[model samples]
Target: MSSTPAPAPAPAPAPVPAPAIADRPPPTFRQKAGFFAMIFGMFMAILDVQIVASSLADIQAGLSASIEEISWVQTSYLIAEVVMIPLSGTLARILSTRVLFSLAALGFTVMSFACSLATSLEAMILARSLQGFFAGAMIPSIFSTAYTMFPRRSMGKVSVVIGLVATMGPTIGPTLGGFITQALGWHWLFNINIIPGLIVAATVWSCIDIDQPEPAYLRGLDVSGLVALATALGTLNYVLEEGPRNDWFEDQTIFRLAVLSAASGCVFFWRAFTYRQPIVDLRAFSDRNFALGCFFSFVVGIGLFGSVYMTPLFLAQVRDYNALDIGIIMMVTGAFQFSVAPLVGTLSGRMDLRLMLAFGFSLFCFALYLNSFLTAESSYWEFFVPQAVRGVSLMFCFVPVNRLALGTLAPDKLKNGAGLYNLMRNLGGALGLAVINTLLVERGAHHLSYLSENLTLSRPEVQAYIDRLAERLGDSLAGGVAGDPELAAMKLLFQLAQREALVMSFNDCLLLIGLTFGAALIVMPLVKKPRD
Candidate 1:
């Protein structure tokens, strides 16, 4: 009676056709230019971190700084970068990409010029720290911009490109630094950055652009978080920078700084989580893949950076290799690493990333253990074996962990992942260097004592060896002469002392690397499969 009219036949349900797969748009020419320019800038920034390796002695001599104080040159830059990493995302949102990158390049160039002119240790440290701030902002920005330029599927190839670009830092840094320091002086180390920085800054300004951040996410800068972070990192660096000279915890000042660092570190992490607007999205931890990848990445960081820092020290100082010679040795491993990047990059997607990582870690542990056996008379080939194996391991490391970290993450989470990755890597490097440096000092002293006791002149073997050396010299048995046996025995004794010292110091460095890699290897099986 209501005359429903059968509800108009309930309009036939609309056909539910299958969803369409959208074709990705091609990259614009401007994008190509910006992407490569950013790659170049990133190369230069990373290069700066290690370029000073060969020039450390010259810089120390030029500035009248001691071995202990000279490390500030490295520490200052590390400290600034550490502080800026968490802030990279926040700053990226606040400023347009083009403006931010250009400003960073400009500031970095200016700071390099300042470094060239620095006449005092303090001045150089300040300049290096300022340069670090700019470099810090640019690294994540470059990675973010480049990765987002293409669709997700294209990330593998892009990662290979980035790994190659990044490899230039360690590969060329020592070689170029050697040539610059030898041909010119240490000052040229800073001066060379000026032209490259300007070229990249102009190129980036013309090519890159990004729209403003969403207003809702644009919270005020977290100054409290900054203060807490700075205090912790800065305090910790103070302890590391001074520990070798101050005798570690025995020094009251270093003790205080260490205490302050631990306390401030805890507080900063707490406030960062509880704040209205956190500096970094610590919630990135909610993703299991990201978190686990980061854990392994950190151990890898300690192995990579610590070895880089310590090996050069031993080569330059202990082995008496000029920077050029050091460059030649390092080239062995660098070449090995460069050749393997593409393979690892491609294979990571197809194979189980965890298996790949575990294999790499195993090789790393084996290499460090081999390196621990180095003596003062060790050949280049002897060291090269372990180093070259590590070089192969590094390829697996540089690409796989990064891809795995981002595997299950959404697009929006990438920037946060990169930032956290950087910060943790730097921290690992700092801890690695700190522990190795401390142990080298302590262990070297202990080994010397043990060797002296075991190899006493009163021992029959040592006395016989001394007599044989004296007899070979064919000089008066009782008196000293230019080539006399008494003088010859003394010389042989001195050589043995030097050998013991070198072996003990290098042993300590290897111990650090071995333990770190071994621990990571043991924990590898715990990383869960892709649940997403």
Candidate 2:
């Protein structure tokens, strides 16, 4: 019966691709070494920024540059680095991981030499900018390699390494830079990169054999998209870094740049979605876990980098601590994180990542809440425990966050996803730093005004305190060894008021950071556990 030949059975649905994290062979020794070499290079690159940060004073004096010009040493690097970060994915595709990383390491090494030899502000800034470009190229490459070179079974362990390197550079940078500068001099900061850079370059060149170059991709490159992205990231970073310094939108330059950043960002996103082969496939974000994971990552940056920035600043400005002392205090956080990393990595593989993330954020909130109690008289002991909590929290946060972000990405989209993930983290940090700085200034001013309003001669308590202070200084004033008694008392009152105001501002800042972390928890439900 030719009666309507049985409709051909619909072709079996194409097999759904599983995440790469399933059971797999362990990485061989050479693969491990090569991966480590890439990580080391990344660490060195990230460390360079913070190392120079601690030694900027020396660099300024050595080069005899003005404050504005000397600031470019950092500004230039940051602008270049931010611009290059998102582009790294496309660049890697064109050059291949092995070739791209090798060139980056080599270029970075040469630039370090150039920077060390730089004698003028112009020379140093130019060298630093170039160095930053190469160094920025290496960062996402390390992240991408971690996913590509290792199996899913090993990513948890890889997360441990990535977290350490990510945290270690900023955490220990000031300490290392201080020691190096004191012992060897500021030049050593740049010179130190030479040997390590060469070794990393050589090791990566020899050991990394996978991922052949797809030079043809370069020909089809999204030129307009690249420009839009560069403008968006570069201008945005410049605005964030310079806004607090320049009073934000009040400065015409910053305001103009802000507009440019927004316009370019819009263009970049539009092109990324519309283009057949966009520079970065924003479509990876369609995965619910990845989108939520990135949001968590952004919050992580706010907590991680914000704490690093605020603590040192408070120690330096309010506590009168030296760079080395501040670095020492900050190192405790790094130490705590390092100690717990292996354990956290192990647990992440066995536990629900969402729970780990929740626990981590809770710890961050607790630490920040505790930190909000900081007083002008607070010492290293006051910070030690909170810093330890923060360190441990970082371990818990990074491993699970990374797994959730990249676990579901298709192999082809892994690099692009990593780039965007990293960009969000850095953006969060920049925004946090800018907002915190502005809050410190604005909140401090508001607190000062409020505190000052009640501090008047008409108030009995105010008058009483002034009289007491004036009487105490009377003997010295009579002998002419001290300044005017009335003036001295007024000075003392003003100093006390200023101190109180600053303390309040710092507390408010800490509270805000804590609340932000707590609020981020609402996104937790969006992440799904990896399928077995």
Candidate 3:
């Protein structure tokens, strides 16, 4: 009994003191330089896609490619990019962040040069796909490092730069490309990456020195999981890109791809849950904040990419603005994002993130509503305010949503979580663009039919408008307007009807976008706030 009492009376161990804030090691100047290089690489990757947008016609001409073949230039790049994004997490783990980032930058640089030198459509597509693959590899690293490389207190500051680069690259790509192409020729668009890419590669290789490779983890590589994930994302991306263009399920290829995507996705998830070391960890979704953050990310992606797609289409198609002018108008949105993102990031440190999300979504919805009023007569001035609102709202949406999703994960899970989080946004963009395209076609047709039905020269108002248009044409054109007045009037009426149909369709699309943002707002409360 005495022995047991003596054993029980062992003294308590001394209390361990928590490390003070000042004791934490800060990032060195070299690491910061490496980060900016990574940002530059990411910027180039995203910007390349947009830069090529304004110059695709020239590319088509230079390669002697058909319109259908030219579309593959973009399709190939996008498909490759999407497939590589999620895999980056696993790749980084195996190769180490430093090596992976350096290789990605180098690969992207070489591909960009190859793209510039491509002599045929096939060559261009191949190079572009390779470029996209490497580019996608760089994206998740930027965000993952924002959380993993830096301290939590500095995340808002880090995110500001990443968000700005991400937001601006696409936002201003067309404009920048237009200028480069105009001054330096289309080949320069790809060649332009040479200097910057070299700089980035050198900086990344020489500077980044943080992550350590786990050779043991590579031994457990999930081959089946990798193939399944690639199949799921690749086929899904193809379906999204081609669905509306091909009338979705009506086209056998799209239908087949969609089925493959679904099956592959099911298999991937099953593997994720059952495998001892699956490539991806689906368990991350079980976190409430991550799940809801992803939900909202998908919604915001719709607004982000959808608006980018829509506004340019509106400017080019409806207003007949040149690529440069369209780019300039869209830059209004980017300008606001660039200026406001830093401020928002600073405020994020001190403010209630939920309230910020609410405000952001509200402002975005209002911008969409404003866009709903667009007409054939709408000009840059008309888009200016809405685009600015949209720019600010983007910063608000991304910063908060990013914090919510990945902020609560364990450090080990950061890479995987970042990959999945980004994948959702890209998928959302793809799906949103598809839906918007389908909507434009379907709604435009519906509006056309309805408008045509009432334009029989039966309505007096219709006749009067046509007569007035004819009179104006007669006054303006030489040789009595070249056709019979009645015939000309009818033709003009049809044109007007078509334009009106397009405007109505766009308005409908914008309204739908607005409603989607509002829905996202409704889901905001599901997220639990993390400590600052």
Candidate 4:
């Protein structure tokens, strides 16, 4: 009967309340120093993604690589980076932030040096792949640290710094690359990382103290899941990057990789859901805001990378601008992006993030719409307003989208969620580029064919155009003599038609990219307004 005295069972233990924004301690100097260093490392990582883009020709010539082989310089990096991005979450947990980030920075630096010394295409590809794997680890770790290290109130400023770095790195990449390649050489592209990389590694290793290494996580490594993930992502990236160039499934290699990617992807997903400790925790998607945020990130990626890719290309192919000229023209976007950072940081605190995101995406769509009017005669001034609008819009989009995606994740979930979030953006960029390339080729051919069909010699306009061109050619020739003036005129006419068709295709691609942002707008309301 005295057992009644033991009653009430010591009422269930109350859960510990999370620290309030005000209650949380400010980041110490060490944390701040470590964070900035990590941010620098992240910039290097992302910048390298496109630094080689503008200077691919130089690398090609340097290594005596064929047109097809030289592309692997970029492709190998992208494929390897994609595989490591999602896997970084697990690695970070097992190794701890300090150890993982330091190792990544050191490894990335060493690989950069190796790349600079590469004497063959094979060596460059191997070095670049290893470099990308290390680079991928640095990127997500910065994102996760930003969320976990700072308090809620400080996120506005923290987001601006991280957002500026993330978006600016890629935006200004080609510009920096072109300058470096033109003034120095392509080898400097990799060489530039050595000094900065060493500093970052040393600083981060000494200063970072975010969390302890979970040796238990290493014990539950999920080896099968890891292999499946690597296979799935690596094959998927290769297929996406090479598919457009290889005529998609028409190439046997692409087709086989596509199948392998699908099968490995299925295995990866199955392991993620059933395994006790998944390599990438799929449960993050169960958060409605995170899911919607990732979609926004994907669309933003299409805008961010697609524009960077297309603008330089149009200038190179249509306007015949060299790397330096294109870099000069591209400076507008980077300049505006820098100017808008402070304003975005201020607005992030006062404005409803959803509204800010809407405004940002609206500007992005408007900018793309402006670009759809591209002509072969278009020059820097023609691109100025659109690029500026895009730059401003990206700052707006990046800050809010990043906050909305990872801001609400629990500390325990932030690392995995950040990895997944970054993976989506990169995937979007890869897929967007593939689709853009395919569209450019197919649409260019269709337009060219149509123009040819309508410009037959039987047409009165065609004959008149030919006669005028012949007369001009004859007048321009030395001693007023021309060899088969009509034949020369025909050749000139075909060249003009080809140029017009290519411009039209560029216009089509820009319009489609704009429509993608428009579609993203439709889904904006599904994102729940974040809690105050």
TM-score, one value per model: 0.88, 0.93, 0.93, 0.95
Which candidate model has the greater lDDT, 1 or 4? 4
lDDT top scorer: 4
Give the lDDT of residue 483 in candidate 2. 60
Encode model 2's per-residue lDDT on 1-532: one tens digit a residue: 2422232221121112233546445668998898899999989887877787677889999999987678788878878877887888888777778888899999999999999999999999899989989988898887777766677777888988898898788778777887899889999998989999999999999898757666656655678899999999889988998899899899999999999999999999998888756787788889998899889989988887788878887888799898778888988998898899879988877888889989999999999999999999988899999999999988888888988888777767777788888878878888898899899999999999999998999999999998998988885765333767877887788889998899899999999999999999987886798764
lDDT of 4 by residue, 119-141 (tens): 99999999999999999999999
Q: Give the C-alpha lDDT of model 3.
A: 0.84
**Candidate 3 residue lDDT tens string, 231-288:** 9999999999888889999999999999999999999988888776688877788888
Model 1 stretches astray by more than 4 angstroms: 1-26, 64-67, 214-219, 470-495, 528-532
Model 3 per-residue lDDT at 385: 94
TM match of model 2 to true structure: 0.93
Evaluate model 4: give its lDDT: 0.90
Candidate 1 vs candidate 3, lDDT winner: 3
Taking the candidates one at a time, how many backbone clashes does each contain? 0, 0, 0, 0
True-vs-predicted CA distance for residue 275, candidate 2, Å: 2.2
List ranges where model 2 is wrong by over 4 Å: 1-19, 475-483
Please give the lDDT score at residue 45 for candidate 3. Answer: 84
Candidate with the larger lDDT of 1 and 2: 2
